[model samples]
Target: MKHLSRLNKYFLKYKWWIIPGSIFVVISNIFGVVPAQVIGYAVDLITENVHVYNLFSGFNRQEIVYDIFSSNLLYFGLLVVLLYILRGLFLFFMRQTIILMSRHIEFDMKNDIYQHYQKLSLGFYRRNNTGDLMNRATEDVNRVRMYVGPAIMYTINTFVLSVLIIWSMFDVNSKLAIYCLLPLPFLVIIIYYVNTLIFKKSGKIQERLSDLSSFVQERFSGIRIIKSYVREDYTRNMFEIQSNEYKKDSMSLVKVSALFYPTMLLLIGLSTILTIYIGGMQVINGNITAGNIAEFIIYITQLTFPVTMLGWVTSLVQRAAASQKRINEFLDIPPDIQSKSNDETEINGHIRFENVSFTYPDTGIQALKNVSFEIKSGEFVAIIGKTGSGKSTMANLMMRMYDVEQGQITVDGQPIKALNLKNYRGQIGFVPQEVFLFSDTIKNNIAFGLDQVTDDEVFDAAKNASVYHNIIDFDEKFETMLGERGITLSGGQKQRVSIARALIKSPKILIFDDCLSAVDTKTEEDILQNLGKIMQGRITILIAHRISTIKNADKILVLDDGKIIEQGTHNELLSLNGAYTDLYNNQLLEEETKGI
Candidate 1:
């Protein structure tokens, strides 16, 4: 229950529903416990000629009624029927309110977790798997909702009914009540141990479920690779192994749960048997009336349901607590990056990195070391390097995906940190080396970030990216739906659409992160030619492996081993005959050899 404290805020939000619902639960259970007393009084009316007035006065005085089918008997029977009707009504309203409140809370929790995931930094996603996070948001949230709904309703019903029924039994015969309830303390002790085991087992079950989910998600996502390499049997065997682990954990929980119900029933059955034997002995001795013994047995029978349900209710509570703990861990993690600044100034895209250095978290290798560069507004800068040479690292810092550790990056003479991240990133358009598109229409994918993009804007951007003709060739054209990650499109087509998506933003700064690698040389040349016109009066940074891609830029930077090895115009670097020259000569030789 203490683990449920995190939901206090939501409970407060929904108090209007919960408070009345709880009252109804009490009312319903109170009504549900009244039948035992009614039956006892009716028996007294028949056997001992005890009238209703004598029963309420707590006496066994004999008073004969003149008529057997009197108005009083009819009225008492009607009252019992009305009590049951009220019980049903109150139970209905209680379910309507509390159960619906649980659903609403589940909805809010799912939304909150999704929004929190959106706000979390890239590093958090890197640390956690998709299936684990998905399970926490969905399966774990549902488990918590069970605690707030059925578990709460049953627990309250158990307590209230237990109290009312036990009170009625004490009124009938205190000695009988004592003998019946003496075994209840041991039931509590049993529940205490059983619930602890349930909590432990439930956590393990959820964890194994998450592991199985992750395994399934990964295997499905990579099914193409599995089939391509003829590893279907291998993947299936791996899946079976994970499924068995989940099954073992589930069976362990089942074993613990299986013991709980029978144990509770045995204790409850023992108490009931003891009550009957003692009350019968008392009746034989004339210490208590037959009506009193009848009423005591009825109350104990009424108590049996709530007592037996104790084990199940405890399981729900313990399971919910375990799930809540998992969910709270996610909610408790502080994001590694946040936009704390309130500045709203528009950016002019004069970017500079001064003595910048960065190391990825949990990795000892430094990605960039004292690397620095400057690009004024309207300048075209190109970065050329081998793979893992900090080319993409610079672009990431520019986007503030990860902030620099040693030095500062500034835009328009303002520190990048001082600018709100959302606003800052909004002004720059980026196309990564590996393009990703949503499973949506081509037009929507192209105009992804921008709202209310017109047909002209979409067509013009597509043309500028040299992909408009390819789009129009399709029957549905821009309206054609794509498969996941645009798998229906060719590699070159995907890159072109990605470029068009970026171009549609009409940003003041554009970054091409080796975006042309998939396109043919002729199409690449045409795209760059159009990009030159679009790059006018806007900062452009090109990151590429091809020497031909960056040769015409106003400035070219060559990097190696996380350090900038050379910086000059293409002709100047060619004259220097250093790292840049070596890369150019090797590429030119490859082209010549291929021509042969």
Candidate 2:
């Protein structure tokens, strides 16, 4: 309830719909109960007519009495039908008002949740699984809508109808009404018990559902690996185990739910019995008419459905609260990284890192140590290092994906963290080592970084990346759509497309982080030559391992472990005959032996 109480704002936001819908509930119930009185009246009039007919044995007199009774019954029947129609009309109005509001609220909440998700930092994603995130956004939000729509609507309906029905019963015959309602307190006790059980189990069921969803998502994403290992049967068995556990938990809940309705019916049946037996006795004593007994029964029957719905409404609310709690957990989290200032300062070519040190928080592994370097205007600097030597870490720092622990990174004599995050990153064209492309057309993929781009711009970027001819050869040309992660494209083609995406941005600083590894030397050289035409007045940092890739760079820094061991021009590094020389010679030997 505390978690559900957090949704008061939505209620207030849609109060106009709710307030009118509540009035309609009351009005509809008023119309709904009027027919019971009409039926009772018809019963009394018929009884009187029959008694009069019994007193006169003449055939013509009996016929006249029968005619009067038929005419009276028809009038009452028409009135009852008219009342029912009125009730139904308001019911429709009720749904249009309240239910429609729920849908609107659902839309707003989903957007809010998604917008918040996009603001969270990389560390948050690393800490949470995709299944849990998706469950909260999709499945959880859907359950919350049930509470807002059906559960709440039914609750109000049950309350209003119960109040009206019980009041009418007591007004006609207080003593009989008390007996008929004797089973109600017991019903309350059972609903409380069911609510407790459902609240407890609902949370567990959702957690298990998240687990199941995550398992299926991850396995499907890696289905190719499963087939490669020839372990489809193993994966199927694992999925069966998960599905069986879900079924078991769900059945346990269903078993509890099964107990609820039967017990409810038993109590309802008891109420009906009391109305009949007790009201019959009252009629014998002349305290009430038999017609009144029929009326009490009709009233009890009307109340039956609403009272029975209490258990279902309780279940919906419990599930909704559990789901909303999960959603709120994500909503309440503040991003670990955000811009400290709104200043969208222009980035110059002067980028510097002073005594930077950092560790990956998730793993607590030190990725960089006292790394200091500077890139002046139009400098083409290449970083070469072994795996885990912090080559990628430097690129991450430049992008401000994470902040340094010991020192500061500055752009144009300002702390990088102080700049607006969006504006700062917008100027840097970064092609990560692990390339990713959306399942979209080739032209759209190339121009992904921009809001709008012309066909000529897309072609030019593709040409600069040396993939223009490959794309033009496709049957769909630029319109050809790729599969998931661009799986339809070959490795080299995928890398080239990623480069084109970065190149299309027309950035101030270009960081190509080992993105050319998939392509051969000839294509890589062609791409670099094409890039040179537009490389003026922009700082370029290339991180790669192959000596041939960085041989013509203005400067090269060799990293060993987390520290820089050597920094010089390509010729100067060879003269030193250090780590750089050894790496260059080994690659040169391989190329020569292969007759390249």
Candidate 3:
């Protein structure tokens, strides 16, 4: 119950349905016992040809009023039919209202989880697998719904039915009731044991499902690599191994679940045996009529079903609790990065990283150490660094993907944290080294960031990125749908399309983090030529390894071993004849040799 309280807000939202549904559950059970009592009286009237009033008096009263219903089979039949009609009506309301509420709650919970996932920082995704998250969002949500819906409905039904039947049993014969109910405590002990096993097994089952889903997601996403490496058989065999493990765990859970029905039935059988034996003895001793014994037997049978349903309901509660725990773990995760203030301010793209030092979480190596730089508006600054020299880390920090551990990052003199994160990120256009495209049309991918973009604007951006010709060559042109991550396109084509995506945003700041690596040198130069014209007054930060790429920038900063070793224009760096000079000479020699 405590575990499920997290969803109280949703429950309260639909309490009108739940309250009325619960009333129907009680009402249905109250009238459901009528047919059994009526049958007992019918048997008594047939045996002695007595009036209904005589049977009601148990043939032990001195004064009995005869009525028109004497030996009346038709009247008893009509009464039983009316009682069942009422019971069926209440049953319909109970199932329709309560069960439907669960679906609504499930819908609400799934959206809530998805909305939360959208707000989580990038670092949270880095630590969790897609499959595990998907399972929590889908399967675990359904399990929790079972707890709030059918489990709750059945529990109420079982209580109401049990109370009604037990009272009738006591009215028939209190001694028989005592004997028949002796096994109930033992049933509780068994249910407790089953609940423990189910809780443990259900957790394992959900984990195995996540593993299987992860395996499938990875295989499908990397199908090209799998075929290129010729590891189809290996991948298939591994899938089978994972699938088999999931099957085994599921069967084990099923085996534990399978015990509940039989355990409840065993207790029910014992109770029934006690009822018959004691009930028959009471009748033989002339303590009660045969009708009383018949009614007692009917009440025991009625109690058997509700008692038996207890096992299933208990299992549902346990499984839901396990799922709730997994979901709560996700819901409880605090976002590592969030906007402290919602205040929005106009940004001029005047960025500064003042003595910023950052080490990645759980890593001993520092990604950035005392890094410091500034870029005024409209400056075409290029950052040159070898791999792992913190070039991308610098970009990530600028975008606020992760905050600095020391010092401050500011935009237009306002601390980055003080500005709203969404508004801050909206002003920057970033093209990362690894480009990702959705499985959608080319036009949609290009215009993804902007809420509204005209076809002319998309075409202009694509033309600027030098991808317009290639897109027109395709049969569907810009409407061509791509495969996962744009697998159908060439590497250079994908990079150009990604550039177009960033370009279409028309942002105040543009970042190209080694984005032109896959394109040929001539094409890269042409794209940069177009970009230079479009970036007249916008702050542009270009991260590249090839010296030729950033040779004509307004300023160049050389980073090595997490520090700024040199900063100058290309001509000034060449005149200094330092690290930048060495890199330029090596690249020049390689090109000259290639020409030969």
Candidate 4:
């Protein structure tokens, strides 16, 4: 019922089609009853020796049996043909209408889920698998559409046809109808038990299927790495295990499905036998006419069909219910981060961290503790740290990926939480160590996230990042498609394209998080020099391991184990002779040795 309610709005939206569609189904079913009654009337006419024709005149006792048989046969044949045509027409329109409605509903639901996913916090994706999310948005949604499209209509048809058949049977012979319906209570009980089992097993089956999909997707995406390490056999074995488990679970569902129809048929067969024997006796005793007996048989057979359909419909409903529960569970998860304000505010890019502390949710270990920093607008700052030094955490916080537990981060004197999150993020641009580019044209990748930036502006941004020449050199120029993750481009080229993407945003605060590590030292130096000149009046924060990368910064902060161990300009930090000096000296010695 809840699943049906979930689809109510969509049904209502297309009610103009559905209402007529349902009416047609009813009309078709009603006409569908005519043949059985006609058969009964024909049998009665023959038994009574009544004339079927004198060319549409009233009953004539003088007419021959052949004339009666021929005339009634012709009438019955015509009636059957006309009714069948009407049934086909109704079925055609009904299917078309429901299919159209289901498609629209599925599309809208998928779009809504995708939009909601976009608004969800980064932690959601961090905890969920890409394949599982894909299944939810794709396979699960299609399941719902299947139910809405055919399962729902069939269920409704089964119900309506059952009621009409039973009612007509009662009118024909109440005692025989009661006899035929004796097994219904027991049938319902069995169906209820089977439905419960189906729902539970179907849920597990879907979850296992999701896991299987995830394994395959992960292995395919990392096939190169597996081959490089000669782990093909290992990967294949793992995939085989997952695939076998999926097959087992699916067969488990099939076991339940296979039993359902047979059990229904058993019950229906019992009801049919009871009706025939008892109704046959009544006809022999002259308590009911041969026509009524014929009509009762037809109704009994029709009753069994609905019972059979009910069992199948129950299975479909259970499957849909299980899928709905999974989808609802995903939809119910609230985002970890919530924005406190909706209004967009102008940012001057003055960032401040006052005694901030943070612990990752899954791992209770503190990633940052008592960290404090202040950077005025238009200052070029560099953060230098060894691995696991909380440098990335700082950048993540500025982007509001994870919220601070005990302290506040402010931009231009306003608490970041109190500003519109989208606007706040729009003012900052990031280039990470591992660049990600879509399998799209170079121009589109560079101009990503910009609503309407001019082509010339895009070219200029590419030129600033030292990637314009390479793009133009390609046969397709800016229109060249970069394969998955920009795999077609070299690591340095991918990084430069990422840099170009960030530069085109023209954000107030630019963060380059170890983005130049893959490039040659001379190219890195030139890129940094150009970026420094371009960011003269903006807040630029560089995270790097190389001393040359931070030597000209207005300020440099050295982080160790989530704490700032030192802070000063290049000469001042070198004079202090702490962690910064140790790193610089090590690098300087390595360079001299290479020179030697």
* Per-model TM values vs. the true structure: 0.95, 0.96, 0.94, 0.94
* lDDT (CA) per prediction: 0.88, 0.90, 0.89, 0.85
User: Model 2, poorest ten-residue lDDT window?
Assistant: 340-349
List where candidate 3 sits over 4 angstroms from the true fold: 50-71
Provide the lDDT at 203 for model 3: 86
- Please give, for residues 1-596, the per-residue lDDT of candidate 1 as tens digits: 77789998998999999999889989998888787678777776766544444464643332334354366678778988999999999999999999999899999999998998888877688788999999999999999999888888788788888888888778777888899898889988988999889999999989998998888888887878999999999988988999998899889889988888888888878887898899899888888777777777777777778987788889998899999999989999977778988777777899998999999885667989898888989888999988998999899889988878899999999888888988888889999988999999999999998878899999999999999999999999999999988998999999999999999998889999999999999999999898889878999999999988888998998999899999999999999989999999999999999999
lDDT of 1: 0.88
State, as a TM-score between 0 and 1, how close model 2 is to the true structure. Answer: 0.96
- For candidate 1, the TM-score is 0.95
RMSD of each: 3.8, 1.8, 3.8, 2.9
RMSD of candidate 1 to true structure, Å: 3.8
Which is the better candidate, 3 or 4, if ranked by lDDT?
A: 3
Total clashes in model 2, counting residue pairs 3 or more apart in sequence or in different chains = 0
Task: Name the candidate that leads on TM-score.
Answer: 2
